[model samples]
Target chain A: MNTSRHTRIRSIAVLIVAALILEVTTAVQYYSTRSSVASVIMEMAQRDVSTINRVAEVKKIAENALHHAVPEVERLFAQGDRDSLYRVLQQIVREHPELVGVDFACKVGDDGKRDGYFTFRNEETGGIQDTIIGFDYTERSWYREGLKHNGFWTEPYMSRYYVILMSTFAYPVRNDKGEVVAILGADVPMHELSAMTVQLYENMNHSLVPVIGLQLLGLLLLGFIMFRSIRSVRRLSEVSAEKDLINKELDIANDIQTAMLPDSSQIHEFAGEVSGTQNVKDCIDIAGSQVPAKQVGGDFYDFFVRDGKLFFNIGDVCGKGIPAALVMSMTQAVFRSVASKENSPARILQDMNVIASQGNSTGMFSTIFVGVLDLATGRLQYSSGGHDRPFVISGGALRQLEFKPGFPIGIMENATYWDFETEIAPGDMVMLYTDGLTEAMNGEKNLFGQQRIVDAINASGAFETPKQLLDTMSQAVAGFVCGAEQSDDLTMLAILYKGNSAADFPQK
Target chain B: MQITKTVENDNLTLSLEGRLDTLTAPQLEAEVNGKLDGVKTLIFDFQNLAYVSSAGLRILFMAQKIMNKQGKMIVRNANADIKDIFTVTGFSNILTLE
Candidate 1:
């Protein structure tokens, strides 16, 4: 009972812990997921806004530099000064570091063909370098498109002079005749903006790595708890199943133990209401009671009337449980077989001791009180083998019978028991019990001693029937124990002598 | 349960204190299990011993049986309560008490 309760408590605790862990893990996961998504979105938005602002700032700087150089180059071209135009282009490239190059394309001989001089910074030497746009310069899209559109930003292309990706801001130039003559342009490198965007995406990926790893760890922990809980539940069921099987076996054993004794139903009837009106001649009222602390116990009592004599015995093995129970049953069988042929309780005990003591390596022993009551004479012959001396109640007074002590059976091979005789009158009772009665303990650890036994018999009324007498003793012990757990098997046997006068019974 | 052992020559004395019920009988059993070789006398001193149950009696019986084969065993200083138990159980016949 206690073990199952403890298991229940432990199971509840485990479930609560599991539930708590699950709740914590789910809450952490939900909040982490939400916050991580929000962070990623916020990072992307910031990156987009910053990238646009950077590009716009660079565009404004390039536009300012280009507008500043357009007029100088146009004035130099109108003068037809090639050196001054070249110097002006080189100065534009040097003045604004964001501009990769500067160029001027002229339409010559009215054929709408174009040639231009491009000046660019040499990145490694930090020097200005010039290249002539002499080969099919009119076929270039920037040159053709620049002539048609003013202040146009051209598609990005590879700069042959600077060997880098570049985009041009083209401004058309005209002479004092207000006719288009040439196109002036400023070029900017495109790699800077693209590299910044790549860096932003790389940082976002780095930030998500820890979050993904933490989610995996949480999942592993949950799996481990699930496995442990499953295993414990399986083990708990197995234990309960095993307990049930043991209990079933004990029930069967208890049945066998009870069956081994004489049928108590007849004894109960003899000691029941019939005692007040039925025949009292040559008849004895006897009853036995046994209560084992466990499902099966080591205490026993038996009685059978044979050849006009009542042969009876009560015994308790040294220990409780199965080992003691095995000895108890064996002893009972020995008593029955020996008493069937012998009339002397001493000899029966002697033969039993001899048989029990042989090869008793485990040192197990039992205390027994054997008796023979002659129904005709009311003479009782009894023997004690390390057993408690019985109490005889006569004339409203209870007295303990005395006998010489002998070692408990199975302890010494040569131990001898002596017979003690006592005469019983009509309306007298004899009580026999094991030490489990006197040694029974209460919650305070105090024993229900021999004095209490006498008092209980007295208080129960000396002339009560054997069954009522045994019941009174049982109630007394139970009351004294006060619901404390029984520590040993308690047994009691009562035999009431009703006298043997033929005139008292009338043969009914 | 506490057991104090004193061995001098062939005489071995074990002083036991506290209760020797079912739970602590095995401790005394382990101490005397197979260590009695060459001993001519065994003495159990129970001056401080408090209580004993049937399980404890079984252990004492085992020790007495062993010593009976080779030597004599003596139990000494049992209190009134323990002596009553010994007398009632008839252990007084098999065991020599002082």
Candidate 2:
């Protein structure tokens, strides 16, 4: 995969891994929190139940003791020993500090005089007290309950001193004839029950501390993981942006290299010569397309007039991309320099060959075709450096210009080039091309060869001007290729020698 | 067609007038290519030039290649329409301009 795609996949993998980790961690935390809370709540409930049970146990014990004392107090009351009753109440209060007080009451005479003296001890004050019990107590609920029932206990109540108290095991004292005469009672306080409930609340608070601490830790870890993942993603994006910027700069450099070569439209203006009449001569029309097998290719073409001679050249360097572009530019500059001093096409090529061989340390060479058209006689002189021969059309017949191959440019310093001359008639056409044209392949890998090119030229009708000939040739090549990618630079230069009397060409 | 050139400190400046196209490109090409020796920089001034066809583009390509080896080539003051053409054909990427 490309670097960017690989980086993207890696980033996504990291995120997914992080997400899965977070999800699993969160689930664990949630379950742990839930179970921990439940355990704490259950423990608190158990403590509450135990506290209630303990309080109940103590109350039961106090009730049993009070009941046991009540029967004894009844017997004492029947014997009419108030002093003994008071001593028994004092002993009970000393045995149980939780009991506040114990009291006894007997009915008074009708004249409101004391008929009986009842004694009790106030446990809260640690004092023994007695009172002549009044008949008015018969209407009280606790007294009435005790009279109706043989023994009874009362609900808890707040006593005069603001203590929570309950009267337990109240017994009715019987007279000598077996009639109920008075009630015996004992009181208990609830201080121990309140203390147990306070202890249960304290235990619940202690158990919650660890559970809350674990939950907070889980949250902090999740936040940290999320932050780290985001930072990594941001860093990856910045790296991708930097790579893209570098690629753009390389692309710009490549473009500058391509712009240096001769474009097709200007071939006619620069390729040939002008006559004494100041009329343009030897107009060459270049119609070619390029499809790089890679990012860039080495095909190039150039034209210029120097010292009254039209200098035109087509070359294909042996490499591609920036290197080939650089070499092609160098070749053009060398050709221009040599063309200025040399009037003969052969001498110019020889000079260029020497210069190129010296400069080309890479062992690279270029196939070149250099031609000079004489505007005076419509005579074209040409020399080739291991390049394709020209296809000439004359008298409605196609023929290849015969020549021996010379060494490609930059191969040898003293390589000799021979000049060959051809006379171009008014309607005659000369076509110079690179291998890209003949080697162009279709979907079936079939090449558009030289014969096909000749056939296309023969098929095109006679044109009034050189430009028309070029246009027809270009259309024919396009038709032959038919949507096929140009595998290399397809370069073609067609020169038509117009007679002196031909009508001026139409301007675009 | 007329092509005027001035050289100073290894920099060659060509001010183009009339049309730079298939019919007129030879005059400019000949004048520029003949004096390319010792030139380190080339600046094409298209301010007074009225038109350039594909033929003119080819000559400019040749000129740029020549300059690429020696120094740099710059095209200046291109009209809006020509600039649009350059951009569409991907020539804008290839040429150095100001």
Candidate 3:
């Protein structure tokens, strides 16, 4: 997949995994919390049942005390003794401390002369033999229940003094006729049950504290990991953007460098200035060849008129890309400056050498061939800086115009360039080229070489224009290379000395 | 190309007219090189000048380089096109202009 799609997929996968992990953890926590809460509820219910059981145990003891003591009270009541009944109630109270009070109520006779005695105790004071004991036993609930059944118990209720208690386990003392005559009952309080419920609630709260704490810690760690991953992704994106920006800048620099060279059409237009001259222009026509390189190379050539002289120069910097581009611009500027000031080719190169040497901090250099064609004399005065010698095609035979080589520009401060002069007869051509043309290699590592170049020029025979010569030479180099990659900068310049007038030349 | 020179006490004001191109660049270069011995300041008035090519720019570069050692050079009354070219090429950063 493309990088954008791949990154998106990876990000989505990470998010899904993170979400799934978070979801699973939440689910596990939820289930665990549910179980814990359920257990707490179950424990609370068990505590409630245990409290009820303890209350039941206390009620049983109160029932036994009432059952044993109520009979002796009834026996004393049968003998009409009130003091003995009171003593029996006091004894029951001492045996069952959980009971708050015990009371006895008796049926009233018509004389109202204390014929029957009833005793009741105040739970707070534990005092017995109250005067209100004869207050209509038939109207009391415990009395009516005792009268109806042999024994009965009441639901839990608050005492008259506001204590939480229950009156239960009432016992009836019947005379020989089996009619209920007296009733005995006991009351139990619920303080122990309330204390147990409070303890259960406190335990449930304590168990939940650590569970919430652990969940918070887990969330904190996940947040930290996500933050770090996001930061790293941002840094990578910034670096990628910076690299793309730098590449775009290099492309712009390449365009600016290419703009500095003269176009092929412009070069031909400048060569037109020498056209129609008799012997100077009709030297040879080498035509019908073209090769387009992929990238702009570190080669340059220009021709301009200065001081009634035709000044032309072809040069190649040592490298390619931005460094080479900078050097090429500098060389062009210095050449223009020195050409305008000096008439001799040698003096111009000497001046350029000094300026270039001072400015070239990278130790890079350039090879240049500068020439001035004198229109008045049909003479070419030239100088070379370690550049290739030009080839002269004359009388249908091509040969090299050999000259002494000087050091390349920017290599030494005081380097001297020697001048040479060549006289052009009716038909002679001088072809100048960089090493790229001669050194071009085929797939088998065979070079085009200088001889092949000269042969191509001679074979073109009598040509019409200088462009034809350059084009033919370029084609010969391309054919020799045969699809091999270009490893150096290619440049060429051709000049034909046509002598004085167009009448001396033969028609095509 | 026409260059009108007005010499004051220590400053030289040169008003340039017509086109400052490759053909006329040498005339200006020679004029400045001839008269720039003792002047403390040189002013280039481009009120009537129409165009400046790369050749013209080379002369300006030479003038600036020369002035850096001895005196100061100021360019005034530059038309919009020339000013735009100077800004694009970063010459505005190197020269004093008004």
Q: Which of the numbered candidates is closest to the native, going by highest DockQ?
A: 1
Q: What's model 1's TM-score?
A: 0.66
User: What is the TM-score of each predicted model, taking all chains together?
Assistant: 0.66, 0.45, 0.42
| Candidate 1 chain A least-lDDT 10 residues | A272-281
How do the candidates rank by lDDT, highest first?
Answer: 1, 3, 2
Model 1's lDDT to the true fold? 0.82
Model 1 is docked with a DockQ of 0.47
In order, the Cα lDDT scores of the candidates are 0.82, 0.67, 0.69
In angstroms, the error of model 1 at A56 is 16
TM-score of chain B of each: 0.97, 0.92, 0.94
For model 2 chain A, give the 10-residue run with minimal summed lDDT: A499-508
- Candidate DockQ values, in order, are 0.47, 0.01, 0.01
Alpha carbon deviation, residue A110, candidate 1 (Å): 47
Top lDDT prediction, candidate number: 1
lDDT of 3 by residue, A1-508 (tens): 2564566567667777777777877787788788888889899888878877887788788878877886687788788787777777777766677776676766445654332333445656766434454445455577668667777877666555445556656787777676777677775667677677788879988878766876886697589658756964875576567667866776676576666655534434444444444322233222211121324455667666543356778776655545656777889989988898788888888998899889665555677888987754557899887666777777777777656666567766787788899876655767777766765668885667777986786687876667777767777877888778875667777766656554533332
Mark the regions of model 3 whose C-alpha exceeds 4 Å error after superposition: A1-255, A263-296, A502-508, B1-98
Interface RMSD of each: 1.6, 14.9, 14.6
